[model samples]
Target: MLDYHIHTTLCGHASGSMEEYIEFALTQPLREIGFSDHLPMIKWAHPEYAMPFEKLLEYVQRVLALRQTYPQLPIKLGIEADYYSPAEEAATRSLLAQHPFDYVYGSVHFVEDWAIDDPHNLDQWERVGVDTVYELYFAQLQKAARSGLFDIVTHTDLPKKFGHRPTKDFSALIETTIRSYKDAGMVVEINTSGLRKPVKEMYPAIEILKLLKKYEIPLVFGSDAHAPDQVGRDFAQARQMAQACGFTEIAVFEQRKIVDTYPL
Candidate 1:
């Protein structure tokens, strides 16, 4: 098993230290583990959602230091960066250029400057209606995949995690967006985090997995873990799900490149 998306205390919302998460993963049968805590925002606008730039550097330094002690473990340093507008993206890239990360998972955690976790938007189904939200969400995802700074696209159908059923049009939009990512040589992550929330299905659902197979696009696995216990969470079932959808191998990244594959 390979878990590519993970978080630690530096992110504010997540708990546990980097050493704790690595120690827990050492007990599992995982081949690789990556710590991809949320990236720092340029304006420090969302302190509750991500770590600040100064702390982020400190966190990276701490993780890099571990390379000496855990030489046998293939620990990767990475980031899960949220996409905003073009200006924000440029600033984010400028900030990221200062450090070295094994991979970057492009994610859209907001829509028009609003976080998905906003209490007012929690009732997205009742507000925007499921169909409209799904359509808009995938459109943003298409924009995110084309951002050109990320190694993998995280949770392609993330809006579906809020208990919304995508309409036919919405699904088609997702297929088109994913195809674009494939053309760009970026992988999609089957994030298992949704399973821990109210949304029982994986991020993209089984149909999306089949579409990935059809498009011959590579797939990767991420626990999207917020704590130590969540590392490699539900990876067994996720691998089975991907295999059933005809995926023989799941991709992994290092130094912002696809470096390995794990067989299902």
Candidate 2:
């Protein structure tokens, strides 16, 4: 199996040490396991995601060092970077340039200057309507794809995590975003974490999956695991979902290269 979006304890909210995650990955016969922990913020403003900026290099070194002991399996050192626009792009690029990541999974955890979980501002999104939320979401996606730094885009339809089910227009914009990523030769991950969340739907739900198939965008599987047991979880069901969407091969990355493709 290919699991390219595993997180470790370096990020405060996640559980399990790197060794524990690697051990679990090995037991599951994962051909490639990517350490895609959240990226440190450019200004240390976001507390909900990432470890301290000072610890980033050390974490990268540790993940790289682990590859020597587990040479039998490919362990990729990567980062799931938060996508910001030109305003903070300089700092973001500087941060990314510091590490030789195997792959960069660009993500947008915040929408319209606020992270979804912000205690005081969430209810305002409901008033904005799911359609407008979707417009902003896909616009950010296009920005992310054109950023020229990310290798893959994680959880393409993450805005739904706030409890707004998407409609036809939303799905269309998402299809356009996915097609842009595919044209740019960037991989799109199908994260299974949504199933465990209140949203109860995978990123880019089944309808979007069909659009991805039409675009011929390569697929990748990620549990978005933050704990030991979460590693490789739901991959079986993820495979079933991929099969139902007509995907026969799921892409895998290692040492910054597209090394293998696993069959569903």
Candidate 3:
């Protein structure tokens, strides 16, 4: 198995060193793990959410150094980039070009200037209304898929992080977004971190996973770990979830492309 959404302390919010994360992965059943710490913030910046733009090169070099230190395990250098909007997509593209990232996760943590996933921005949910929040979220997700700036989409239904459910059916929006992802040749990651959140379920929920399976979109796994101890956390459930979704394989990435796949 591959738990490819690990984060380090440099991301500002996460704790522990990069080596500590790698050491923890060594004890897991994972054949490979990726250090996908949050990339530098842009547009409406969140200093506490992501690493500083100046640490960009340092983060890459640190991951490269770990590959040498832990040659027995394949540790891929990855980044979790935020897709704020299409207007800021060019900045993201330029940032990605600076490194030879194994896989780039395009996630939408913000809708407009409000950080939907942030605890500080929780009130925005009520102000913007639940249905609109979900609607705007899927809109941005569709745009992210069409922007051609990411290899995989992480935490597809992140608006539910605080357990906020929509009143209306979003099947059409979600299906359209899934089609955009398929058309863009993108992979969708079943992030396990959502189980730790108030939602008490994996990202995208089972319904979205079924839609991905229906659209024949590829699947990948991510723990979205913020600390070293959280590496490969709850992977048994993740595997079961993938199996239930009819995903027989999990995609593996290299140099921003799916080079191969492994059993789910």
Sorted by TM-score, highest first, which candidate order results? 3, 1, 2
Give a tens-digit lDDT track for model 2, residues 130-244.
Answer: 6777787788778878877688889888877757765655556667788779867888888988887768888768888888888888888888998887888888888888899
TM-score of 2: 0.92
Instruction: Give the per-residue Cα lDDT of candidate 1 at 47.
Output: 75
After superposing candidate 2 on the true structure, give the runs of residues whose Cα lies further than 4 Å from its correct spot: 117-121, 166-168
lDDT of 1 by residue, 131-212 (tens): 7766666677777777787888887777766576665565667778878788778888989988987778788789888988
Query: In model 1, which runs have C-alpha deviations exceeding 4 angstroms?
Result: 118-120, 123-126, 166-168
Model 3's TM-score against the true structure: 0.98
User: What does the lDDT read for residue 5 in candidate 1?
Assistant: 88
Give the Cα-based TM-score of candidate 1 against the true structure: 0.93
Cα lDDT computed for each candidate against the true fold: 0.80, 0.80, 0.90
Q: Positional deviation of 254 in candidate 1, in angstroms?
A: 1.9
- Per the 3 Å backbone cut-off, how many clashing residue pairs does candidate 1 have? 2
